[model samples]
Target: MDAQLGLRERKKARTRRAISEAAIALFLERGYDAVPVAEIAEAAEVSKRTLFAYFPTKDDLVLHRFADHEDEAARVVRARFAGETPLEALHRHQRAALERRDPITGLCDVPAVVAFHRLVAETPTLRSALLHYHARSVDALTSALLETTDGVAHQELTARLGASQVLTVLQELANTNQRRINEGRSADELASLALAEADHAFDLLRNGLAPYA
Candidate 1:
């Protein structure tokens, strides 16, 4: 029974990947708005129903890769080691990801990845969808923050505010890197810039902005 379930899950994952790859290829070949679900389904050799089963909307086909990272901040907070604060855990996770130059973190300046960033930025609907995803991530992180703090007054409000700052910094870092890549900067150069940016951003979070208050 377990073997059958594993096989089924693998098959579903493969079908989803095929559908997403087909949609991206079609979108790149023509344009995002110009491509239809039917065309993508045909390209993937799947029925429209099957394609919709994997991805309810066409935009999802291109952006589904982002789903994994959506709750990453929350996950880090929840899984922090003993004696680690939520902010500390999040900063360490982000710094490690930057050191590794993770693509999902937008530290990668590869041409194809940069093109995809440009494509999403150029499309209004995709940009809105991306924003919505980020908003959801902020909400999740807020919940995690509330869970971590003990009996703190206005914990939910504080979490929401902190999550907003964290998300804003991350978004700015990603956009900056994307812009540099668009301007034909080298990945090594972008990595250096990102490391510096990450340091300053996390430092602000760590040292509290009380002086400005």
Candidate 2:
């Protein structure tokens, strides 16, 4: 029975991947608005009903790649090394991702990755979907932050504030990295600058905004 269930899950996952790959390929080739859902289903060799079953909405077919990263910040905090503050863990994770040229960090210069980012950025509907994803990420991170009290009053509010700030900073950094790479900067060239900027940003987070004030 367990083996059957595992096989069923693997099949479902393959179906989902096929649909997403087909959708993205079509979108890239013909533009998001130009590609019809029916056409995508046909390309994936799945019926429209099956496609809809896996991805409820058209935007989801593109944004599904982000599902794994939606709760990434929260997961980092939850599994942080003993004695490592949530902020420390997050900063370390970002630096590591940059070092590895992880696409999430926007430091990857692969043509396909650049094209994928461009597609999402240029598509109005996909941009809207991304905003929704960011909100969910903030909420998840806020819950994780709440568990790591920092001796502050109004802990819930503080956690919410911290979560928003942390995520916003990271997003901005990724945007900068993406922009630079888009403008012909290699990931290797940006590595040091990216690491330095991450360190500066996290230091500010740890030390507060005293100097600016």
Tens digits of per-residue lDDT, candidate 2, 28-69, equal 999999999999999999999999999999999999888889
State, as a TM-score between 0 and 1, how close model 1 is to the true structure: 0.94
Candidate 1: misplaced stretches above 4 Å? 210-213
lDDT of 2: 0.94
Top-scoring candidate (TM-score): 2
Query: How many residue pairs clash (N, CA or C atoms closer than 3 angstroms) in each of the candidate models, in the order given?
Result: 0, 0
> Candidate 1, residues 1-213: lDDT per residue as tens digits?
999999999999899889998898788778899998999999999999999988999889988878898999999999999999987898888888878877666778776777777788899889889987898999999999888777887888888999999988888887787777778787687777788888888888877796698
**Residue pairs in candidate 1 whose N, alpha carbon or C atoms collide under 3 angstroms:** none
Maximum-lDDT candidate: 2
Error of 2 at 1 (Å): 2.2
Against the hidden reference, what TM-scores do the models get?
A: 0.94, 0.96
Task: Please report, in order, the local distance difference test score of every candidate based on alpha carbons.
Answer: 0.86, 0.94
